[model samples]
Target chain A: MHWEIVVGLEVHTQLSTRSKIFSGSSTVFGAAPNTQASAVDIALPGVLPVLNRSAVERAVQLGLAIGGNISRRSVFARKNYFYPDLPKGYQISQMDHPVVEGGSLTIQVGPDEKTVRITRAHLEEDAGKSMHGDFHGMTGIDLNRAGTPLLEIVSEPDLRGAAEAVAYAKTLHGLVVWLGICDGNMQEGSFRCDANVSVRPLGSGVLGTRCEIKNLNSFRFLERAIEYEARRQIEINEEGGTIRQETRLYDPDRDETRTMRSKEDAYDYRYFHDPDLSPLVISEDWIARTRAAMPELPGAMRERLVAQYAISAYDAAALTASRATAAYFEQLVAASSGEAKLSANWMMGDLFAALNRYELDMAHCPVSAAQLGRLIVRIVDGTLSGKLAKEVFEALWQAAGEVDAIIEARGLKQVSDSGAIAAIVDQILAANPAQVADYRAGKEKMLGYLVGQAMKAMKGRANPQQLNEILLQKLN
Target chain B: MSLTLLDVKRVARLAHIAVSEDEAAIYQQQINGVFDLIAQMQAVDTTGVVPMAHAQDLNQRLRDDIVTEPDLHEKFQSIAPQVAEGLYLVPQVIE
Candidate 1:
């Protein structure tokens, strides 16, 4: 029987606010334990939470970017739970009215574009850390992360496979970082996802029971966890065993998910509106200001890149993966007196490969954009073949010299003179008479061999197209 | 619209408060009184009225995003039951 996977994601993005969502505590990561926690963060007596203005502004920015409705008034509710990391035994989260509502994010899955509906994005406080396996059989509690501002974005169950889920996640991650609302650091847990995965027969409208895999910080882990969970559910159904709804944790070491907690009933948090905080009222002017301040969104930028440069939609999407990457492509295009398509190919291919090989970020790339652009210009002007252009690019990366100087010093210039190419082609034809006769006898593939030999005789500096043309003329 | 003895005991357990059976019976009656009062209020036909989360009409006051808290870990940990290496030690709660 055919089975399909359905997934919904809850992404918690730590806002790049300077202070906590409800207190004056520092929200910076990697501080000495509890040093950044204020009295309000630790839930001291008589300490009340004062909402941070910047956190709300960041939420508004996200709402505008997603084309979501910014709630004019929202309320904070206390989600009652017992944990050491949460000092107040409850988390202040929005339940009824969130900051954002009813928006969609378009994600690219292979060549097809799909829009994932966003349920809501709410403002909440993050809990602290519970460091296990230390403190001599006791867990260490660090409240430094407590009360950090977080925007929890929930998505509809629109994803059909693990790849689509990842695409949706990555697109959301890029959008958040591009908007400057979140830093989008997965390592530091600035952005993380909880995936609700289920499996059912194909074309079934009713969704099967789902298991939530919590705290998938990386996209790879999220994909694997969903796949593993979906397979497990399908196997259970095949065996006539019922699926259990529960919370599961992804064990990356074993590459499988295991139940963390089984719920006999839904959690009875007895959610009540926190009387400590008043209703958060956002005015129309506030939303307008946030919309005006937002950078050009990724979708609009991708469309502009495609229309302006005449590049493919795929190239535009890849270029606009991040703001820095798109900026680098634009600068390269401006500096290179070459085709935008050529610049895009080099940027997406060799440039990215070199960055990965050297374990360098775009900011730390040794070759400047202008220098690479000059090298591309050499290829455009026939001063260097594509192969010789790569050589100059390597020299540029090594800071050897300018593009023209490198070509001069290394003799890597393309031999584009048709007269010089014809001499080499004649030498190759004379050296391979049997192959020349074979080519004359309608073995047209041998002409490619003759052209390759001629170009090699020039030590790969000859323009391949010029050599091919000369060889065809001589043979014909 | 009333709390049973079992419901009262469950609520006490959720709150992590230890209560004896005799004490639960008394608390069940007291809590049921509050529930009865709520049921009386719920009988009012107040359809189309928006639910109010707060008693007052004041909006939440916003604070600037600035770090004004000094390091008070030493003072805070001094009152904690367990502390070592600048972290509060709690009974191992890993699930």
Candidate 2:
């Protein structure tokens, strides 16, 4: 029997707000154990929550970006649970009524596009960090992360497999980063996904029970966890064991999902509307302001890049993956006098290679867009051959001055002088008379060898096309 | 919902509260009182009345997103039941 995988994702994205969601505490990551934890963040008595404006605005930006309905009013409910990380016995979260009601994001799965319907996006406060076994016999709790703003985006079970889940995740990640709500840093736990995976008999209308694998940080881990969980469920079904609905944790080291808590320990999170805060109301004008303030979304921007530059969708996707990269390409192409295709090639080729080598972010790359644009301009204007242009690019990376300066310093300028190159070509043809005869006798590959010799004679400074043209003239 | 001794015991256990049988019986009565009131409200024939979540129609006030809180980890952790190495120690949290 064929088994079909059903998947849905609950993504918890930490907003890029400067302050905690309810308190004035710093939301900075990697601070000391509890240095950023304020009184209200730590749940001090009589300390009340005041919603952060930026967190709401960031959530509104996400809603607008996804074309979701932003609720005019949303309420905060206390989700009661007892965990060491959560200082408050009950976490302040939204239930039943969320800020963002419904939306869908389209993802490219193979050659087809699938749209994942977003159930809702609710604003909530993050719990603190609980470090286990840091001491002799106790767990260490760091409240620095407590009260940090989170927008928990729940998706409908629309995904079919691990690939679609990942595509949806990456698309959501790109959109959130494009909206500037979340930093999209998986390593720092800024963006993490909880994938609920299940497998059922093919064409089964009834949905099977799913086990949620928590905290799949990276795209690879998310895919691996879902695959492992799906396989485990399939084996159980084959062996006639019923799948349990439980919360599981993905152990990346073991590459498996283990049951964290079973149905027996399931806490009835007694949710009640908190009397501490009032309803969060947003006006239509506020939504309009946020929508107007948002930058061009990634999907629209990618389409524009493809249409305007006539580049392939793949190239356009690579260029518009990040706003900074797209901005850099735009500047470079603009400076190169509308050389968009060449600029796109250089960006994905040379710029990506250099960034990978240096392990630098595209935002803080050493080679400025203006500087790289100048280099491409030089190549476009026929001053530097593609080979010499690469050499110049390396020099540019190493802080070797401007493009023209590097060209002058390294003497890497292309020799396009017809007379000068023809003499060198003549010398090569006369020296390789036997090979030239072979070329005439239909060993057409010999032409490449003759041109290579002429280029070598000119110390690789000869323009390749000019050398090829002059070589053909001299041989004939 | 019907009141039951076992349901009361389960709720007390989930909330980590010790409930004697006598106290459970008393609390169950009180819970039934609230449920009765809710039932009475639900029985009203005002089908068009929209349910209100709060008493007043006031919206939540927004606070500017600024980092104004100073470090008070020392003060907060000082009052914790257990503290070690700038961390609030608790019974080991599994999973």
Candidate 3:
């Protein structure tokens, strides 16, 4: 029997607000422990939570970006639980109503484009960190992250496998960063993912009982944890055992998940609307104002890239994976005088490879778009062949001068002069008689060897197209 | 409509607080008296009245996005029971 995996992700994105959601505490990471925790954050007796307008505006902006419905009357509810990191013993969150509701994100996994249904994106405060290994025998509590604003985006279990889950997560991450709501930094815990994973018989409509996996901080770990959990469930079902619905923790070091808590230990949080907070009411003017300030979403940019540049959907998707990358690509095309196809190819191919080699993102790429675009322009303008262009690109990667200057300095310009290329081809024919004879005696592949010799004799400055034409004419 | 001693004991256990039998009995009596008042209120129809979350019905005051708090770890940790370096020390919390 074939088993199918079902996954739904709850992504917690820390909003890039300067202060906490409910308090005026600084939200800067790496602050001294408890230093950023204001009186309201530490739950002082008299301090009250005042909602930050920027957090709400950021949430509204995200809702507009994804075409989600902004709730006019969302209420904050207190989730009662016992945890040391929670200073107030209750987390104020949304239970029934959330700020943003019913958005869908479309992700591309290979040839398939799947739209994952976003259930809700609710605004909530984050708990502080409990550092266990910091001290010799005791735990250390850092309240710096307490009361930080987080938008928990919940998705329906529309993803069918681990790869689809990863695709959805990445698309969501890009959207958050593009909208400027969140920094989308996975390393510093700005973006967190919790996956509810379950496995059921293939082609069955009945859903299987799922276990929630918590705190998958990285995309790589998210993929690996889902796959491992799916396998574990399927193996248990194969052994005639029942899958226990529980919460589990993914141990990246062990490459497995351990049971954190079960239904027996699950907290029955007595959820009640927080009396201290009034129900939030959003007006149409607010939505309109936020929408006016919104940047172009990645999906819209991808469509424009396809229509404007006449590139493939795959290439357009790759180009608009991030807002910065898409902007860089546009600048490159502009620098190349609207050579969109060549710009797309170079940006996605050699430039991307170079960025990866240096472990850099498009935002911090050492080479400027104009610099790379100039190099690509030379290739398209017949100043350099593809082979010699790569050599120049490598030199540019090492802080060599501009494309034109580098070409001049190294004398690496394409030997496009007809007389010069013809002389080189003639020399190749006279020097390699056996290969030239083979080229004339119906061994059509021998023309490739003759071309190689002509290219070598010209020190790779020969225009490959002109060299091939001249070499064939001389041989025949 | 009223809480029994057994219910009171169960609630105390859920809260992780120790309650003696005598204390449970007294708590039950006190809670049951409150429940009787709630039962009287529940008897009224009041069906058209919208449920209210707070008495004031005031909108949440919005704060400007600014960092107004300075680092007060020493003063804050002074009130805490345990502190080391800058972190608040606590009994070992696994997971």
Candidate 4:
């Protein structure tokens, strides 16, 4: 029997704020144990939580970006739970009223594009960390990350497969980073995902038991975990056993998942409105101001790049995958008098290779856009051959020197002069009499070999197109 | 409001507590009492009303993409149960 996999994702993005959501304590990670904690963070006696205005504004901005309905008034709820890491014994989260609702994100999976409907994006405070390996048989708590603001974006069960889930996650990661709302750094635990996956028989309406995979931070892990869980559940159902709805943890080392707890072990989280903080009321003026400050998002930028530069959709999408890469492409294009297609090629191919070789980011690239632009222009205008241009690029990248200066210093000008190229072609034909005879006897493909030898003798300075023209004239 | 024996067992398990049979029956009544009060929420029509998740209409705050701190090796090891040359020590498993 055919079965369909249903998946939903709950993504928690750590708000890129300077301080904790409710307190003025620094939200910086890796601080000494409890050093960044304030009275509100640790939930000290008589300490009331004060909402951070910046955190609220950042959520509003994200809601606007995702086309979500920003509620004018929202409330915080205290979710009761007991854990060693949770200093307050309860996490302050959205329960009944979230800040944003009913938005959709479009993710491209395979050759088709699909929109994954987002249920809601809520605000919450993160719990502290427990150091289980520390303190001689006793776990210690670090409140540095406690009360850090998090935007929990939940999606409806619209994804059909593991690929779609991964695409949706990547799109969300890019959007959050582009909106300046979250760094989307999975390694730092700033952005993480909890995926709920279940399978239903094809043409059946009833949903099967769903298992939630918790805290999968990497895209590769999200895909692998969902695939593994779906197959595991299907096998269980086929073996005359009912699948249990439970929370599981993904073990990347083992490449499998283990049951963390059963559904009965789930926390009721006795949620209620927090009394200390006031209702979050958003003003129309604030919305308007935030909207005005919004930058061009990835989708809009990709469309613009495709239309304005006459580049393929694939190239445009690859170029605009990240804000830094898109910015670099734009700078190169601008410097090269709008040679957009060439700029795209260099960025997606040569520039990307260089970055990977040195393990460097585009922002820290040693070669400037203007210098790369000069090299591209030289190749286009026939000042340097394609082969010589590559050498010039390497030299300019190593030392921030002028492209023209490097070309001149190496005496690598292309032999675009017809008379000079024809002389070299004549010498190659004279040396290879058998090749000449073969070319005359309808073996026309041999003409290419003669041109290659001529160019090689010219030390790759001979323009291939000019050499081809001169060689053909000499042969025919 | 009264708590049920089932509610007591479920909540105790969630709370990671091992309840005795006698304690389970006693806490059942306590949980039912809480549920009866919570049943008041069902009286209001929430059909079209969206479920609330948070109180504040706040967005997430973002930071600049810059590393702010140097790598802390010695300090991180200070709290470890056992440490040798900046590395945490754990009991041998394979050998």
Considering every candidate listed, which one attains the maximal lDDT?
1
Native contact fraction, candidates in order:
0.86, 0.85, 0.79, 0.01
Estimate candidate 3's alpha-carbon lDDT, on a 0 to 1 scale: 0.90
Q: Give the better candidate number (1 or 2) by lDDT.
A: 1
- Residue-level lDDT of model 3, residues A1-476, one tens digit each, is 99999999999999999999998888988876788998989887978898999999999988887778999889999998877788898999998889999989999989988888999999999998898876879888888888999999999999998999999999999999999899998999999999999999999999999999999999999999999999999999999999999999999999999899998888878888988899898889988988988989888888999999999999999998788899999999999889999999988899899888889999898778899889888988899999899999888888888999999999999989999999877777888889778778899999888888888888889888998888777777
Q: DockQ of every model listed?
A: 0.87, 0.81, 0.77, 0.10
User: Each model's TM-score, in the order given?
Assistant: 0.95, 0.96, 0.97, 0.87
Of the two candidates 1 and 2, the one with more favorable DockQ, higher being better, is 1
Q: What is the lDDT of residue A160 in candidate 3?
A: 92
| Best first by TM-score, ranked | 3, 2, 1, 4
CAPRI category for model 3: medium
Please write out the lDDT profile of model 4 over residues B1-95, one tens digit for every residue: 56557767877876679999998987777767677878897778888887653455543333332223343435544565665423334443120
lDDT of 4 by residue, A40-70 (tens): 7766578877677778878888898788999
Standalone chain B TM-score for every prediction: 0.91, 0.82, 0.88, 0.56
**Clash pairs detected, candidate 3:** none
TM-score of chain A of each: 0.95, 0.97, 0.97, 0.97
Clashing pairs in 2: none
Q: Write the per-residue lDDT of candidate 1 for residues A1-476, one digit (tens) a residue.
A: 99999999999999999999998888888988889988999998999999999999999998888889999999999999899999999999999989899899999888788999999999999999999966889999899999999999999999998999999999999999999899999999999999999999999999999999999999999999999999999999999999999999999999999998877744679889999999999999988887888888889999999999999999998899888889888999998964699889999988998998999877788888898898888888889888888888888888898988999999998888888988888788889999999999999899888877887899998888877777887888
Which parts of model 1 have CA positions greater than 4 angstroms off? A423-446
